[model samples]
Every structure is written in C-alpha cells, then in structure tokens.
Target: MKLLILGGTEFVGRAVVEAALGRGWEVTVFHRGRHAPPAGVRSLHGDRTTGPEGLAALATGSWDAVVDTWSGAPSAVRDAARLLADRVGRYAYVSSRSVYSWPPAAGLAEDGPLVEGSPDAGDVPYAESKMGGELAATAAFGAERTLHVRAGLIIGPYENIGRLPWWLGRVARGGTVLAPGPRSLPLQYVDARDLAEWTLDAVAAGLSGPYNLVSPPGHTTMGELLDACVRVTGADVELRWAEPEAVLAAGLEPWSELPVWLPPGEMYDAMHTADVSRAVAAGLRCRPVEETVADTWAWLESIGGVAPRRPDRPEVGLSPEREADFLAKYDPAGGDR
Candidate 1:
C-alpha cells in the first residue's frame, strides 16, 4: 500500500510513519523538507499553507491512504482534500479531544458535541484548527472515504514534549512534587505506537467517521500516575497539592505552558476520557501501561539530559502543616484536593 503522510517528521506523525513502515507499506511524507524523513521513506517538500504547490506535487499520484497530522487550519485541509479525494482510497485526519466542549462528563463518547473555531487560535492552532480541518475533510471525501481519529494525550517513548516525561523526570529526582489535585482524579493517555497501529487498521478495514483514541476505561488517578513514574525512574518525589492559581502565583508554570503540552488544561480537572470501543472492536489493541512506562524511561535515558532537571529542591512528603497551608492557599473550597 502507498501511504502519504502530512507532517510525519515528529511526534504523532512520526509514530504513524514508523508503524506504517513496519507493516511494509510504502510511505511518502510531505512537509517543508525541514526535518529528515524516517529511514527508507521518501520525502516530498512544499508548503501547504501558502499555495497549491504541495498539493500539485501529488496531484497525479494515487495512494491507498493519506494520513494528515500537520494540517491545522480548515482551509489547508480543505485544499488537500479537494486535491486528494479522487487520488486516495481513504483519508485520515488526526484530531484532538480538545474539539470536545469543556466539562467532559464520564462515559462520554464520540457523538459528543465539539468546539468550533477558526484555524488560528493564537499560539498553537493545532486543536481548534484540526476541528475545522476535520469538517472540511469529511465534506470533501464524504463519510465513506474519510476517518477522523480524535486522540487524547498521547504518551510513549521519544516523547520530547512534556507529557509523561516532565513529571517522571521531576519525581525521579526525589523531591516534593506539585500535583494538580487528588490521587484518584481521571488521567488518560494513549501510546503513540498504539494510536498509529489502530489508525492503520482503521484505514485497512475501510472504517469511516469519527473515533475517539483514548485509554481503556479504568481509574488512573494523579497519585497512581505519579507513583508509576517514581517507580520506573526510582525518583524520590513527594506529592504536594497545589491549586491552579497558587501554582501560577508561585511563578511555576503549569504543564500547559510547555510547548509539548498541546492540550491546554489542568490534568486533574481536564478530563479527556473517551470511549474507544468502536475502534477496539475494529482491531485496536493497546500495550500495557507498564510497557509504556519502561519504554519512556529508556527513551529518556537515551536522550541523556535533553530534558533538564529542575533546580528546585526535592519536595519531601508534605507535612500536616504544609498540607493545611497548601489547601488554604490553593484549594479553599476543599474541592477534590
């Protein structure tokens, strides 16, 4: 199968490219030629934002599938879809759970309402722009030829961005760690490889429409998540509850401040849970969490301090007085701390 992937140089796109290549699929990547393509993959260079030159390059080429991970704006996706609708058998657009409206109640499914906005939402336009892009692709190719994979926080090896690695690195150092909220708060993440595998299966099976790519239903709390990090890295870190506002007041930026924290929200309050039964039933199997954690640690070690260790002193276990002080300053209402 010939697969053309847009923005396949890094993160999710790169993971998809790797998975496709492992399956022995002929993969071609379209980007600005900024980064080197993965080994054995051909690279095509052009700017999708400025003109039709990039689309024109693939105008005559036919592919079994096209996975779009880079088109942030709706117009960009619309342009691409118009060009590839007849050229490809299936078109997959990488979207986000951010498209869903805030306050994601438990047990929410893919049929939930979505947020609406333009392609550019200030600094990072990927989420909102992808929402618009999904609409355009669906319109261009129709449901039969299009599939939207709305992914949640993707965690796995080589995650240069601060998702799981940020907290893991912090805890590995053995100090008081600032947790957003309670230990049992909902936390969900999907390994990038798992996502890529499922996406490929979806294309191969000719699955269409929207599907939520998230972890299986289970309770993954803030504490458990941190504890797992500590266990893997052997970092001696203490847990400290800090309100969102207090975290800002202390001049400590939330994880969202980091460029890698794409989905902007408190990990505790921002519940991005979704039901992926449809995708799983269609042959999407996820790796165990332990494997993900081990792989992540291995990748971090391989990088060798690419992620700088925070200079702050290790936070010893919070004392009663400290806990009280933290609650008073951060969570006056005592709401789920």
Candidate 2:
C-alpha cells in the first residue's frame, strides 16, 4: 500500500511511518524538513500551515491512505485535507482525547458530549484546536472518507512528553523511590507501536468514523504500571507508596513532576478512565505493560537516556534531597536521616 504521512518525523507520526515501513508499505512523508525521515522513506518538504503554496510538493502523488499528525492549527488541517482530499483513498486524522470536554463524566464514550465550541471560537485553547482540526479534516474529507483517532495518554518509545521515560529514569536511580498511591489507580494509555499498527489496520479495512484509541480504562492499575517499570528497569529500588493527599501536601504535582499520579477529585479522574470497549473490540490491542516498559527502557538506553527535558526546569521525579525529606516525614519506617 502507498501511504502519505503529514508530520511523520516526530513521536506518534514516526510510529505510524515506521510501522508501515516494517510491513513493507511504500511510504512518503511530508514535513517541514526540520528532521530527516527514516532511512527508507521518501520525504517531501512543506509546512502544513503555509496553505497551498506550501503544499505544492504534495500535489503530485496519490496514496491509499494518509495519516496526519498535524494539530498545530485547524486552518492547516483544513487546508491539507482539502488539498489531498482527492489524492488519498482514506484520511486518518490524529485527534487527542483532550478534544473531549474537560473533566468528562465517568463512562463517557466517543459519542459522549465534546467540548462546546462556537463556529467563531478561535483555537486559542489546545482542546479547541484539536477539536477544530477534527472538524476541519472531516469537513474536507467527509465523514465517509475520514477517520478520527481520539487518543489519550499515548505512551511508548517515541513519546516526546517524557511521562513514561521520567518514571523509567527515576526507577533506574535505584533507591527508596517515591511511588504514588492508592496502588490500584487506573491509567489509560496507548503504546505508540500498538496505536500505529492498529491505525494501519483500520486504514486497510477502510474503517471510518471516530475511535477512542487507548487501552480500555481500568484495564491497567497503578501497581501494574509501576511494577512493569520496576521489572524493566531492574533497579535495586524500594517503591514506597504514599497516599495522594500526603504527596500533594508534601508539594509534589500530579501528572507533571510526578509523571502518572492523578488524584481523585474533579480534575482528571474521569478523563483518564474513559470507556474503551469500542476501541478494544475494534482490534486496538495493547501489548502487556511489562513489554511496553521494557521496550521503552531499551530505547532509552540506546539514546543514552536523553529526552526532551527542559534545561531550565529541574528534573522531574523527586530530587534526592526532597524524597529523603518526604520519607523522613511520611514513611512510617522513617528511613531518611
């Protein structure tokens, strides 16, 4: 199959590109030339936000499918979709779960109410921009020809967010580590390779409409995820689980400085626990948590554990001094000096 990918050099986009290539598909990547495409694929230089003139290079060839990872601007998505509407047989637009209304009620599906938007509401907010991109793609490609992937917390090797990698590197430190609790807190994430392979399958099957593209909610717990991290990192660390209230009271942030801990309250309790039965039934297979953790750590090793961590911002996870302080105060055993 011939595939065209927009923004294919980055995390999720790269996942699809590599997946398709591994399957021996002829792939062409259209990007701004900032990063080189993988060795085997063809690259076309263009900016999605630059309108028709920017996309001039893309007018020449046709493909069986197009996987778009562009969410910078809705106008860009609309323009790209319109420009290639006739050239591709199917269009797969990568939309995020954030497009759904924030703090969504528990058990909502893809058909659940989305963030309310005005036709005139500019994409000032990230959620609106993504939803606008979805609207733009569907507007150009039509519902029958477009596929919207509403992905939540996408984790795996190429993740730019540093969530999973933060945990992996922390575990590798091998000490009395601050593990978040209650230990069974559920996490929703899709492995990039898994999402990519499933995307190719959906495109091949000519499936359209929206799919909430993450592992089923409540399918994996906090213990499950952290255990996988420990097993993969092979760190000689002791995971000391602390209650969310204590963690927050101690000044650790959820989901940011502390990677995957979402405290129960109005913020994101429902967001991460969205129902994914539809996605699972649609063949969205997630590899075991251990496998994802192991592979991600392996990839991190290959790259010398470098990631997009900000130099100005101090490293995430607990600073040793802080963790020691917290343990002295919070850990019943008071292991800190």
Report the number of the highest-TM-score candidate: 2
lDDT of each: 0.71, 0.82
> Lowest summed-lDDT stretch of 10 residues in model 1?
308-317
TM-scores, all models, native as reference: 0.79, 0.92
lDDT of 2 by residue, 210-237 (tens): 8888888766888898888899888898
Summed over model 2, clashes come to 0
| Candidate 1 ranges with C-alpha deviation above 4 Å | 117-127, 239-270, 307-337
Clashes of 1: 6
- Candidate 1 lDDT over 29-92, as tens digits, reads 9888767778989887778877566566767788999999854557788788888888888999
Model 1: lDDT of residue 101: 76
